[model samples]
Target chain A: MMSARICDKIATAIAWLAAIVILGVLASFLLYMLYKGLPVLSWHFITGMPSDIRAGGGVGPELFNSFYILVLSMLFSFPVALGAGIYLAEYAGTGRVTELIRLSTESLATVPSIVLGLFGMIVFINYLGLGISILSGALTLTLLNIPVLVRVTEESFRAVPSYYREASLALGATKWQTIWRVVLPNALPGLITGITLTAGRAMGETAILIFTAGTTVSRQAGDFDLFAAGETLAVHLWYVMGIGLVPDRMEIANGIGALLIITILIFNLAFTIPGRMLQKRMTGTRQ
Target chain B: MSATIIDHHRLKLMYDRYVRYLLFACAFLMTFIILSIVIFVGQQGLVTFTEVSPGDFFFNAKWDPSEGQFGAMSFIAGSLLATLLAVGFGAPLGLTGAVFMAKIAPPWLREIMRPATDLYVAIPSVVYGFIGLTIMVPFIRNYLHGNTGFGLLATSIILAVMILPTIISISEDAIRAVPGSLEEASLALGATRWQTVRRVLLPAAMPGILTAIVLAMARAVGETMAVQMVIGNTPQLAKSLFMPTSTLTSEIVIEMGNTPFGSAWGNSLFLMALVLLLISLLMIVAIRRLGRGSVV
Candidate 1:
């Protein structure tokens, strides 16, 4: 009996130790990145453009490209993703079509970003002859974002009580009217959260962009040419560290990393804060 | 009054039918986009499958894109080898962490750890790649010299860290789903906490645990940025984990540009995509089955 108790104690201790180590690794990785990266971060580093010999370069163009690609992709993906989500949650009958949709969405989610990159290369770059352009990259990212948004939006829609829909219908509102006036407003927060998360994923994405969004850092920011190739912050980070950029490349990479972290943090806050507050308000009112 | 009521009813019926059609169209559009991508990839990849032959692509070691002699065997092997190594090292640690979070940790600790996992997932793959390149590569270079910095070991370690979030989150869900009643029953039989977890709860949650591991494997295998950054991008199969190697995805990235349009190179990219698609399909199936089975 005493031996068994000792064994139990040993196992518990091991479990705790494992948890601590795993968490420690995660925390340490973040801290080390910031530590090695922060010293190089500066205002000039954020706002400046690239110079010769890898010495005096900044990521101004890269930042613009990242934002541009993100906006374009979101613009393309949002309506389709939301439409599909609504169909699945509110309208689809139990049949082959629904099953196929579900299976495809799941498969789409799992198809590695690299494969998407490959597909983009073949269809967008080769077949359509779009070349390596931001349009092609944005289209590929739209494909990537749709599956995630669909799933999240579907979940949010389902979470809404059925009575709300019924109440809207009972008031002589048409089905579309009910959805627009009642269901959509209630699900908007979750939908926004989902969209923001997808945007974050798209922003951090590197593989798909490698093929479609050419690696050239634009010299100017205001160019609205979709056909022109461009690089984003993430890709810039990869190129700088991978292939030796200017002299201040390490600092530039750190600044980019810091920015990437901040962007994602904003995304997470966008997702969770409004969500929790709305839930709290609803529950409080119920009580 | 009767005529007005009849007209309203007719409009309602027509609107319902139209809405149903709209829903069908939207669903069809989603399916069309996914299927079109698959078809496009397969159509383009057919040239490689036909020209290169299965034996050469799967069994040959060399990946000479310049000569149109493309064999992805080494890359495939490297990806699988790295993924296996990652799972070997990461699975136990992740499972233990999950168990601790779900069963052992106090409420406050659980709350903190939960968000930490979220933050881990939210960090972009490129950032992970950057960190690995800056920190892990130098660390490995310092210790192991020529064979260390860029190899399967570095790639595997980075992948292990990258997939940690998946394993922890999924396995935690699995462990938490294990019934308290089962624990009570084991304790009633004089089983200690450890015994209950090891013998009863673990067994019951085996499928969930397996799902978590499989999902982690899927993520590890599919990971590109971090692995690409760390792995030396060498196209060869090596006996030692310390030796440099390339993966299928990394190969696609490296060779996609050099491959001529509508040639075997393009087809090879498609072939790689097909492999990835099949693996992901298997994972989704496994996860769905496990999820359904564990609903109790």
Candidate 2:
């Protein structure tokens, strides 16, 4: 009994030590990056065209490419994902079909973004002749985003109480009406959070874009051309680190690195604050 | 008036059915997308095996594409080693942190830590890669006595951190999911809180914790940019952690741009995807059956 007691105390101490160290590590990593990254940010870094000249490249095109690609992906994926979410949450399923959807989505989720890129290259670039275009990358991204979007939207919609649906239906509303009006209104925050998260992912994604969207920094008038190759901010940062032939590769990395971190941080907070609040409120109200 | 009411009700029911089926079709369409991806990867991946024997593809020492050698033994080993190393660090830290978050932390700390973990999840892999590239790589080279500073060890550390949020978030939920009644029963028998947690809560939560570990492993193995940026992108196997090696993801990235269309090299990369996909598919099924009620 004495030995067991001693073992418990020691285990607890170790757990506490591990917990504190993990937390400290996470904190220091973020703080260190912010410290290292902040000094490199400037207006020119955000808007100036990247230069081929040594030590003079800017991230202006990369940032634009990131947003453009995100928009393109979201444009196509959002509707289908939201539709799937609605079906899962609002409709009582026939079991097998719903099971298949759940199974397929989960499977799709595991198909790595890198593989998705390779697949996109094969199908879109080779077969469809889209080349290394924004459209191809966007299509690949849509696949990556679908699983997460469906899960998020489903969860958010499902969190709305049964009573809300019941009341709406009893008031002479149809099932579709009740879902679209009563359920969707409540799930808007969740939808927003899912979209924001997906957007953040699209911006940060590098591997998928590597093959689907080529890495050339175009100075041509094809900035809006979906057929043109678009290298994203994450990919650009990666390029700078890997094969970027600039004298100031480190400086460019530092600058873009800060913006990428800040952009993601903003997206996270933007969704997470409301997402958490909505989650707490729903669970709280349920209890 | 009653006839009109009947007509209105019928119309509403029709609309409901139409909408429901439409949404179900959308869900069905998602299934189509998954199928197409598998088929696409399958069709392309199969091209490599036409000329290269399965034995040669798996066992050959060299992976030079220009020279037409496409064996992926080292890259496969590299990915496994990377995942193994990351899971080693991530699992312990994550499990302990989850325990602290769920049962030990004060409410105030929980509030802060919860959001911080969310932020961690949202941070880009490239940023991690960048930090690893500029900082960790050099640090290892200077202090850790590496030739070029990039290696398996640095990649593992980044991956460990990257997978940490997944493990902690899911495991914390699992711990919290353990019935409070179990803890109360242990306490009633005069066990300390630590004993209750260790003996009761953890056992009850074991399935969920396993699920978390599996998911984290999947994520770590699939991770690309961060691992690539710092892992030295060497095709051959390294003898030690302080040396450079390639992963499947990194190999695809490094070689794909230079690889021409319809080449044996290009198709072999797809075969790598096929392998990665099949493994994850197996894990996905495991998770679905085990984690039916859990959030991914």
Candidate 3:
């Protein structure tokens, strides 16, 4: 009996140790990124333009392109994903069409980002003749983001209470009216969280953008044309490290990494905060 | 007045049917998009595959894109090697962590740990790539060579770290689903916690663990930027983990622009994507099997 107790104690200790070590590794990576990346971060770095080899450069263009691609992709994907999610959760029967939708969505989620990149190249760059433009990149990201948004939106809508829907109907509201006024409002937090997470993913994506968004760093500050070739923050960091860009250019890459991390951190916070608040509210009401 | 009321009811019925059709059309559009892409990739890629011998494409030592000698053997080997190494390291660690959270940890600790795991999920892939490029790659280089920057070892470690959350989250869910009564019975029989977990809980949760591992494998294979930044981007097969290598995803990214519409290089990109699609399909099938097996 004593031996069994000792063994139990040993296993418990080891389990705790393992969990702490894994968490430590994650924390250390975040700390190290901030440590190495913060020294180069500044307002000048944020807003400045690319400069000579010796002097430091800014990531203004890359920043602009990242936001532009993110906004464009979100604008394209959000409504379509939401519409599909509503169809699956609210309207569709469990038949051949619904089964096909489920299977495709699952497959789409598992399909590699690189495959999406290849598809974008074939269709947008070749067939459509967009030629590595920002518009093409946005379209590629739209495809990539849709599956995730659809799944999340469907789940959130499904979570709404059946009683609420019945009550809205009893009040003489139309089906569409109940969905918009009662169901959507109740599910708004989850929907926002999903969109923010998807947008963050689209912003930081590199490989698909690498193909659809060409590699050239536009030195011309005033040129904001969507059709012109451009770089994003992630790609710039890659080029800097891989090709030994000028000293200032390297600094610019570091600054961009820091900024990207910050943006991701914010999105993560947005994802968790609403869920946490909802949990707390439920507990408080129960008390 | 009676005729007008009947007409209003008929219009309402027509509108309801129209809405249902619109919803079905939206669903159909998604399926069509996915099917068309897969068919297009297979058609273009098969043409290129015919030009090269299957053995050469799968087992060749070099990939010379410039010379029009396209062989994906090295990239395939590198991707598999890195994924295996990552799974070897990550699976045990993640399973143990999940066990701790699901069975051993106090409620407070579990709450804190759960959010932390979710945070790991939210961290973007590019940030992971950046971290790998800046910190992990240099650390590997310094210890392994003191001069060279990045290689397969670095890529594997980064992938392992990036995949930990997926493994832990899924495995924890699986472990939690195991019946508590079994553990209680084991304890009453004077079995050690270690024995109970190893014998009762883990075996019962094996299918879940397998599902988690399969998902992790899918993610590891599909990973691009983090591995790309740290894998040195070489196209040849190497025996050493410290040596440089390329992956299909990175190759597609690198060669996309230069390859013209009808060129073999472009077709090869499609072929690489076809390979990825096949792997993911295999993963889905495996997960489905595991899910069914668990229920039985």
Best by TM-score: 2
TM-score of chain A for candidate 3? Answer: 0.90
Order by TM-score, highest first: 2, 1, 3
Question: 1 or 2, which is superior by DockQ?
Answer: 2
How many pairs of residues in model 2 come into backbone collision? Answer: 0
Candidate 3: chain B TM-score against the reference chain B: 0.90
Q: Report the alpha-carbon TM-score of model 2 versus the true structure.
A: 0.95
Model 2 lDDT at residue A81: 88
lDDT of 1 by residue, B1-296 (tens): 99999899888879877877776676677778778877887777766877898888889988887787778889889888988999988898888888888889998888778767777777888888888887788888897674568888888888888777778888888777888888889999999988988998888888888887887888888888888888889888977877888998777776776767777777787787787777777888887787642210
Tell how far residue A34 is off in model 2, in angstroms.
2.2
Compared with the true structure, what per-residue lDDT tens digits does model 2 show for residues B13-122? 99889888899888887788888889989888888999788888778758888788888988888888998899998899899889989988888878778867877777
Candidate whose lDDT is highest: 2
Pairs of residues clashing in candidate 2:
none
Instruction: Give the worst 10-residue stretch by lDDT in candidate 1 chain B.
Output: B287-296
Top-down lDDT ranking:
2, 1, 3
TM-score of 1: 0.92
- B-chain TM-scores per prediction: 0.91, 0.96, 0.90
Model 2 chain B lDDT-worst window of ten: B287-296
Off by more than 4 A, model 2: A1-9, A92-94, A220-222, A274-287, B1-5, B289-295
How accurately is candidate 3 docked according to DockQ?
0.50
